[model samples]
Target: MSGPDRVAGRTALVTGAGNGLGRAIAHALSAAGARVILVGRTLGKLEAVAAELGGDSRVAACDTSQPAEVDELRAVLSDEDVSILVNNAGIAGPVRELVDVEPAEWDEVFAVNVRGVYLMCRAFLPAMIARGGGDVINVASVSGKRPLARRTPYTASKMAVLGLTITLAHEVGEHGVLVNCLSPGPVAGPRMARNFRLEAERTGVTSAEAERAFVSRAALPRMVTEEEVGAAAVAMLRMSGLTGADIDLSAGMIGR
Candidate 1:
């Protein structure tokens, strides 16, 4: 299970890379010999991940959801010829019915999950196109397709991500940019724990019980791991011509 890492020539910018799934993918890209730039809002966390990677890895504490910050970060990366962009930044909007959702909360979630992707693509895709080819991997979710109940904002945001992936793929195919989405099911991480807690509050069940219910939807008896999601992301990095496609690393979750 070993071969030469071919990503040495590539430079990858991973957003939300301070922890969780973002951190795992950053590590994977680095392990595969790519120069990785870790981007997140938390300086301490991003620094910690960068130190662990222990290469020429760089860190930029930038909140992807903020247009000004995204622009500043883009300027910081202007010198580097970024060849791969992994839009992994996201937030879980409040778990509530569509009518009960707050406008502020909805904007908060979309600003990060949806608008951030748009800004990043706009900021970096031109350089990628000019350089000949690149990868724009958007981290989406199963709820994007199956529409998880009581999570209107999160679901809608991801559906937008899915649609964006497809349309961007078509728009940039002539420019050698491959746009695709990675839809992961419940993964064992802090985000999943938070989701369980939210579900418990919504359903009057224990977090443990809610977690089991979530996993039961998957074909497997358990949720997937962060490393598994990282592997899926790395796989997407190596493939081409998969524009407008979604690779669901959902452990076969039954679609509703």
Candidate 2:
């Protein structure tokens, strides 16, 4: 089975589905025949995505960083057979040096990027294990494995996600669950553009120059796209043999 056949009849819940990678993933999963659940902090944004999906797809509002909100969301989704869980909710912490980063800022980043993944897994993994199989895709970043200047909290949180994915896979392998993560490079989006602008301000260069410097490290010398990330998620679902793997969709950044 491939393409739509791979995910047909499955329910996929994607966090941060209002925009960026999450929105793209929701669209991809829906296109692949999965009943998608658009989850995010903004109800209006989710509703917009839900309308765009225009099918059995639905929207739910919840702050993944908050345990209470996650618990409430789990209860609301208790009746759905969510076989595919995409823990895509994350936040870019303060773009400043480690010393300048406030303690609360660091904690907030971990709350969404790390603790959010753990909470979602804890809420849904039992049912998946009981069902004898499931798929989990934790969205991480290449920055997790590399040294990114002035991104201490986001980098650290993503690295934690990588560890969580692999260790969780090991523990659930016997039960037939597959867990993996995508460590994408600098994707071409508003997020990256903002980062580029900030970098230009910090490094005394034009935005284009800052972007060039960032992508020059990659063998392909370009950022990935949101659609590409979505397609990668679909491909991961199709490949049953893959588990405990960190797929680097970074335009050969890791290779270089």
Candidate 3:
């Protein structure tokens, strides 16, 4: 469990495994020989990723935000000993002035980004502790480290994740569970494009301009690649010395 396959012989449960960073993490872990459980909302999308993974990897469709769904998901995984848990499922809520955003939309954002991660931990973390040492990597964002204009809900939810990761790390480290957060900046994907479009509409600037602004804080400003995010995640899973800390993969983005 400490070589090229750093997570070898461990079972990893990754949420939002349908695409983007989540997919990249799943691929990286599976390539390293971890038994991967792909959990997401869409079975079809999970199936597609499962096919791409094809090994001992599996698909379990669940909405991380729903209590009942999370319980069922835990039951589905009860038989398999999960040694790694990656909470990557999240949603970018409506981009608008805080006052302009609907309360429901704001709540939904927290439901998925905050409560969802909470539920997953609630279900799987104790089992890992009871069995002995394990790892939990929570995917956060650079926005959580600073304020982002017009993306209040997304920013707030990510901040909550940071806090949760830190507090949980403190609580679980004694139990041999290491919890950490990986805060990536502007990971290139359809999601980033959508965020740019919304920011453009908010600022009356072009989406292209919004993209530049999104990475303005990066000393070496650029879009973060999916492969880089994947590698960072794998690194986190491998590192045993760090806990309750956020590993920033934001291309030197200056945080406020």
Most lDDT-accurate candidate: 2
Model 1, residue 231: distance off in Å is 0.7
Task: List ranges where model 3 is wrong by over 4 Å.
Answer: 1-5
What does candidate 2's lDDT look like per residue over 45-76, in tens digits? Answer: 99999999999998999998888988999999
Q: Please report, as a residue range, the 10-residue window in candidate 2 with the lowest summed lDDT.
A: 1-10
What digit string (tens of lDDT, one per residue) describes model 1 on residues 10-120?
899999999999999999898888899999989999999999999899999888887898889889888998988999999988887899988999999999999999999
TM-score of each: 0.94, 0.97, 0.94
Error of 1 at 220 (Å): 1.1
Candidate 3 residue pairs in clash (backbone atoms < 3 Å): none
In the order shown, the candidates' Cα RMSDs to the true structure are 2.6, 1.6, 1.7
> Candidate 1 or 3, higher TM-score?
3
In every candidate, how many clashes are there? 0, 0, 0
Error of 1 at 36 (Å): 0.4
Output the lDDT of residue 89, model 2.
96
Q: Cα lDDT for residue 189, model 3?
A: 85
Winning model by TM-score: 2
